[model samples]
Target: MPSLELDRYLGTWYQLAAVPQFFNLVCARDTMATYALDPQGNVSVRNRCTTWMGTPNEISGTATVNDRVTGAQLHVSFPGVPTQESLEGPTNYIVTALGDDYSWALVTDPSRLSGFVLSRTPALNEAQWQQIRTAIEAAGQSQCMYLTSPTTGGLSGIAPLCTV
Candidate 1:
């Protein structure tokens, strides 16, 4: 996760899989996150998803690069959501692994409480799935904790990383 180039990482990333976060449990499918460079030198984050009732749910936040050296760690804070935003406390999102072409990435936090498999496209081939699984394991994450996130334009099966 060293030498993470933020410029290359800035873009819309589809959530192929993830460990559920309490606030996002309402989402039924099609989870997505978008990132854009802000004038404040922070990353603008916008997350969207489809709820079980077929409604769109979204939240915008600001992500500060917490790790100045590697730029892999970030502290994200939503407008009204209660979470730490201080640069020195703890990073809520960390790019633990990334694809060679930046097409996919594995992300988590210091506590490893949550994990996400993000890809440039909604769907991936078997080989890409395998790559994500390998990265998850290499990051010391439990595949059992990660479930495939069903997207309207991507994979729908609610399977575990171990089964992928």
Candidate 2:
């Protein structure tokens, strides 16, 4: 894992695709996440999305560095969200892959059970999508498990990666 620069990674990232999760089931489109530096030297996480009911759904949490050496591994927790994601507690949030320019990233846990494809923009070109798939495969994950996150704006009405 490459050492993640928290400073460069701090910003809003559009969710291009993600492995299904109960917490995000409420989201129908326009899913995004923002990160910022917190006073305690940790990171603050704010995830937002458009609900199926046409309303907004958001969650705020904290992400603590789990692997200081790499700064690629973290544990994020939101209020009322499940914490049983790991035996050591806290939901594992790892930056398995990242673009050098910090324009895109692939986030997952140690188990690779849940994964997210995040980008600076809501849409990605074919080459970018292919590169993301390659990165996911290198991380030992099947791209077939991912579903394209629908967006009302941006590129709009894109087919899921699973079909590609």
Local accuracy by lDDT, each model: 0.88, 0.84
Q: Which residue pairs of candidate 1 clash?
A: none
Q: What RMSD does model 1 have?
A: 1.4
Worst lDDT window (10 residues) for model 2? 82-91
What TM-score, computed on C-alpha atoms, does each candidate reach?
0.94, 0.91
* CA RMSD, predictions in order: 1.4, 2.3
After superposition, candidate 1 runs with Cα above 4 Å error: 84-88
Q: Candidate 2, residues 36-106: lDDT per residue as tens digits?
A: 98998888889999998999999888888888799989888777766632323544899999876788899
| Count of clashing residue pairs in every prediction | 0, 0
> lDDT at 29 for candidate 2?
91
Kindly list the per-residue Cα lDDT of model 1 for residues 1-164, writing each as its tens digit: 87799999999999989998897888888999999999888899999999999999999888998889999998888877666444335688999999889999999999888999999999988888888888888888888899888987788878876777
Which candidate's lDDT is highest?
A: 1
